[model samples]
Target: MPTLTIRNLDDRLKQRLRLRAAQHGWSMEQEARVILAQVLETPAQNDGAAWLQRVRQRFQGVAGDDWQPSDRREGTERELPHFDP
Candidate 1:
């Protein structure tokens, strides 16, 4: 088994940790261990694509209004055709 030591902890932080451990029915050491384990674990990416898709959909709706199309057409300025009667 490996042991870790944390030094220079502030009194207020220690008190808060003790209170939180008591509230959760765990010792301070155990609480810290569990928290550290959770912090080090990789978060699941199951919903990443869905979240990206939703963000893209939202931006797509707003993108049209945020940019204007260029005025030039076919390598020249656009001109209306004249009609003869």
Candidate 2:
């Protein structure tokens, strides 16, 4: 068993923690332990690029040439003016 000491806890925060613990039918220490356990046990997705790539790969075959804007000839393409100033 390990011992943990928390210091400088505000009175208002301690009161809120006590209320939350009571709501869940747990002591303040037990509630804190449960929260710590849950937070530590969960795995986080840290790679945004990898997630985006996976999503793009999943829906890769859904679109076709018929859905492209160039496929539909509505009018002549006008290029936007490039401002250098």
Candidate 3:
């Protein structure tokens, strides 16, 4: 196991951490370890593909089995106006 030290942490923040640790029935060090593990183990959602995947996963099967796509196509192209170039 390795030892980690945080230098010059705010007194108020440390006090709050201590209170939280006591509330959760853990020591300050143990609570810090738990917090670090939780925050560090989670995957990042910053990538566009990752975000899209999460969105798809959340709404999976939300449309039900009866959903169908409409057959739509682009409209006819319009002629460009004559310009004196």
Which residue pairs in model 2 clash with each other?
A: none
| Best prediction by TM-score | 3
- Residues 1-85 of candidate 3 have per-residue lDDT tens digits of 8999999999999999999999999999999999999988888768798999999999987967778766554475578999998
Best-to-worst order by TM-score is 3, 2, 1
Where model 1 places Cα greater than 4 Å from the true spot, the runs are 44-85
The 0-to-1 C-alpha lDDT of every candidate, in the order given, reads 0.85, 0.85, 0.90
Evaluate residue 77 in candidate 2 and report its C-alpha lDDT on the 0 to 100 scale. Answer: 70
Worst 10 residues of 1 by lDDT: 38-47
Q: What is the TM-score of each predicted model, taking all chains together?
A: 0.54, 0.54, 0.59
lDDT of 1: 0.85
TM-score of 3: 0.59
- lDDT digits (tens) for residues 20-85 of candidate 1: 999999999999998888877845545798778878978775756658777666488567999999
Residue 75, candidate 3: how far off, in angstroms? 22
C-alpha lDDT of residue 54 in model 3: 91
Q: Sorted on lDDT, highest at the top, how do the candidates line up?
A: 3, 2, 1
* Global Cα RMSD, each model: 11.9, 4.8, 5.5
